[model samples]
Target: MKKKNKSKWLVPVLGLALLAPTVLPTSASATPAKKVTSVEFVGMPAPATAQDMARVYSGASVKVTYDDGTIKSFPLTYKTLFKSTDVINGTPAGVAVDVHGKPIMDRSVPDKPVPFVSDDPDSNSLMKIDGAKPTGLGGNPLSLITHYEYITSDQSGKSAYGIIPASMSLSTIDQNKATGELSVTDVKKVDFSSVGGLWIPCNGSLTPWNTHLSSEEYDADARAYEADPAQTYVSSFTKNYYQDDKKVGNPYAYGYIPEVTVHADHRATVVKHYSMGRFSHELGRVAPDRRTVFFGDDGSNTMMFLYVADKAEDLSAGTLYAAKWIQTSDENGGTANLKWIKLGHATDNEVKAYIDKGIKFSDIFEAADHDTPGFTKIKTYPSGKLEWLKVKPGMEKAAAFLESRRYGAIMGATAEFNKMEGVAVNSKDKKLYVAMSYVEKSMEKDIKGTDASDDIQVKKIKAGVTYEISLEGHQQDKDNNKINSEFVPSLMKGLIVGEDLPKADEKGNTAVVDKVANPDNLSYSESMRTLFIGEDSGMHANNFVWAYNVDTKKLSRILSLPAGAEATGLQSVDHYNGFSYIMSNLQHPGDEMIIPEPLKTEVEGYINQNFDNKRSGLVGYISGLPSLEIKKWKNTNKPDVTLQVAAKANGAKVTWNNKEHTVTVEKGVNKMVLKVGERFVEINGETFELPSEIRVKKGRTTLPADLLDSFFR
Candidate 1:
């Protein structure tokens, strides 16, 4: 009877017999080996204990066992073993093991997981182990660029200049919001003639012809006085004081009024358009038709607006309209606002009538405080009753929503807030997102006086996702049906907007009105819903860039820059071949990235707020290139371990250390002098340079090897 199984195991003998065919067929040599594909690790936490097993055993041999009783082993490290986990708390919280016991990861987590060694010897590559290479591209080390000071310093070969103190008085620097002055000395002094005075922080887009369109974020008092048809003499801030007399047409012209500057063909052209409804503009998103453009004014009381150009030649003569929020009752019996305002045709007489009533000529920031002394809302009594009033052409439909204390502090007049900032469109999804930086004054809360005084507002924006214009509006195919665009929604998803809506008053005292942000409240700010408010005081001030989603009436906060850093100009690097850059600047002396006291704390506070919390599928606010191949390398098999080495004349100098065998290189060139402790080697005259792998095995070290040495040498 099956040789009378000698011993009975914890599992049934009958069951074991049944499982033998599937489990016991392989011999020791029948198993396949485990081959490591990649390795990765982060310096977040050290091994908790010897048994933690998370320790990185890179370059350690891994083996796998196969059904044929065979085994294979290969060297592997941290990255290949597991993918990076970006989310702080989510599925596969820290590290997740694959079928073969490897890990996959999410990227939002502040700390990365450590890699573990495979103590077992049965692993090998033929087992079909898969993993990502150690890319070193995902958020390895966080870097921030602030406190800009431009200077010119001379260096050999490449043109170099010392970054020094220089201030630009333009409205927007680099096409972004007005950030304080930082030093960026990349300008060749001789190129001054090509420079436009406006220094928009960010979000400046290139025109169809590749020119920079910088928005006038604010009404420069000096520029208003000089450029106005009826001019009064009021001076604005000036830089390079001595040159004031030398510049033409109010050196200020180059600085104020949103204008377009063309950079191609070697000629600089600047054109300012005053018809686009002045406000704190963050973007000018031209429609696919290229005739209609949408923009958001960043301010406490902002205006979501659109411009329909009257003539293709004169974009400056577009009809401007302010967006109005229309309220609707939701399934929960709660009210929601879902529509924006568009200006229809209003007769010149009607427009003049409102203009005479003190409709202040201003942008988003100014509109928020239309009640201020100099700010006039241009109150008009329609010929008919409020309910019977007609929505005229060239006139925007008024939004039913109003400002609330918990939103944002009123900056100037403090009447109503319209601070809408970042705007982005996803053509595939046909969605748009608007970022609003709403500011509410202090003293709105009921906290203690001391607390109120200590209270500094924190600011941030929201990515308001809305559907793009329907394809039906575009020219139809012969079938007369809309053509589907191949645009898909980006990975960015739901972002909490105004979640930290203010609760305290200016004196740090808690107030009843502060409760307006909650759904349970009946406060005026809570009742109205057209606009999604974002904090613009503390850290919120620095956020830029908003992307939209078409399907969900939700907005995702896709990216952010340093506070006060506007997204002046943005170009998604061509997925094909090209480098994209983001340019930004502050306007005042020493205004660069300086987070004073409460503000500084606010920035850190914003980042650390969710230190231990994790949101599923949250896209990070990353700037610069999403990924880069900064260096490259190639290798070949050689006959001897010590091959004839010669450094090619690529102008690169090579060096290394043999002690710890660690050496870093600064420049890449053809020939070079190298030293290791007391050892020296002239690589120029050799037939082939030493291979890095062999060098490393020989205990030789090199820094930036890919940049300094060519493996083909």
Candidate 2:
């Protein structure tokens, strides 16, 4: 086995942040804001907690009290923007469409997680929120905020959820300017025809430039496509996406990052960042500097990937690096020093050109199942799969980005990480946190430990552990070439580890309760100094969303997902319009798995009673508090959510042009334009940035509430 570098482990200390001040709203309403000291959710009777495995909370609720001891609590709902089953604009609810904007009605998955399948792998795990993008709002309540959300796929085939297409819904949300409470007003699936359609888009993060950066997980094996281009599952995807069985989908296209740009017209355009290496991407999450990105490859035998763009906030071009883990200790979730092997630099179009030229894996590497004379023996992917591979002389760039995992391994980078999931950054601590959902398989020593080929050898944590990568500037790659970005990962060690219960506690519990078990999705609030961890575990009957205060090191259970459901869609916004937001969503619930006996039966009954049709999940936010409150319009005889800015409330005439997808504000001699989906408005065809965009909702034109009082005057 080949080793990338010979660097020993460097011990690193976990630095904790100082406790942040209480987040209290500054609105002078004579009512004092309640600071959240800690939050605890009412856990359902389920496994691990020694509760009934099947029982789930139906009318879930959250109670908030004021500083003066005035108490008020609302039920779990009354705030849900929409369920996966909610149809808007009279369309099919959450229909999964292919590349051509054609619905692939037969794409399905069985309830519960699948161990493994031939081409399709595990589709049932957790639902990731991918973070919510708030448009047209800077900080403070004077500006009403608009939100957009996305949920990606877990590649399921043939079941009740076939229409949901791994299932993605882009819900349009409206935020109460004063309270920071978010509610869904519109929901629709993003069209993907312009960019070869989305392929298994997984989790994502909102870029600092205010765009959505999402992943396409479980990339179809390119080798399989090369052998029988017209007979593989990818071909089927092409048929579904293009609505033509004759169309064979390109394997090179599905694995890269798909960046979504939202326009003022309620439309989105997608572009694939081929510059980012391909694999089972859980995320291509950007660091604070905006130039650096860390990818989570979510499968067994994957490499830890990092990419630094040539320019800040531009992912179209970058130099990629893969980490070679050098173990220093095998105790306490292990410890490692990381050395990066510099992958060749390229732009998006550079690699896409090769892909367009029909570059094959053989074009990049020479591979064999056994030790052929010239082939290098390496175990790079899956749990036990082995390959003898050698990179082609002139195809360096192709090997680096197109067949990245194999190429990284061939170049001697460590490729034994397992179930490497979500990644998040604590800019304050200058640290990066990543989730390894299952610390097993290749992460163990025996997989490829012989030649230091498999450098990570930590005790398996079936319930999982969240690893922290210490970030520092002035670092260099394994070759001692200076790294371009300041956020290079230096030392890595487990920050939050889950413990296992001695045995199953009736409810089929295997992990200790009151602690993190199978930590998955993560988002950090810089102002709050807290890291939110979501779980996708079979060890617990009910998955949970935990808020880990990094400064105080307190693990608080803020919310509990339904029984048999996975906790996902975790994101933290420090402040948007003066109010902070914690974005969250649960994937599929009501599936029977892992739990035993009466618990399963009870859960099945409960699932049938609660889960609407067993296909819908939820997209919502954490409630109760924010830091500021803008006054709401008196709202006399208006809808729960209405376009009630000052102009609309005062009865000003606004016209909507469906053909142009624009809203015209007519005030004699004031011939100007405010466009939707765009944060800018044109005054007499001269464009200028607006604090917020002009949007058309409910067939009516609406300008930012804060703008209404000033723009037209």
lDDT leader: 2
Candidate 2 regions off by >4 Å?
1-79, 107-167, 228-232, 382-384, 447-452, 626-713
Q: Which candidate ranks first by TM-score, i.e. highest? A: 2
Evaluate residue 624 in candidate 2 and report its C-alpha lDDT on the 0 to 100 scale. Answer: 40
- What TM-score would each prediction reach against the true structure? 0.40, 0.73
Candidate lDDT scores, in order, read 0.26, 0.62
What TM-score quantifies how close candidate 2 is to the native fold?
0.73
lDDT of 2 by residue, 1-713 (tens): 53223331111111110011211212221122234333222322223332333323223333333343433322332134455555666544455555555445432354553211111111111111234444344212111111111223334533321112343445455554322445455555667666676666657777887677777777777776687774444665666557676765678877878877765544556788999988888887788898999988988888999999999988999998999999987765778999999988999999999988878766777777766887877766532366677887998898889878877887778988888898989998899999988888778878534532767778878888898999999999988899998899989998898888889876666998677898888888775567888888888767877777786676766676667777666667654433445666666675546667665766667665555535566655665431211122221232222333544665555666677666665444333345567544433222233334455567655544333333344
lDDT of 2 at 150: 23
Model 1 ranges off by over 4 Å: 1-203, 219-257, 263-265, 278-282, 310-319, 328-417, 439-577, 584-652, 655-695, 700-713
- Cα error, residue 635 of model 1, in Å, equals 8.7
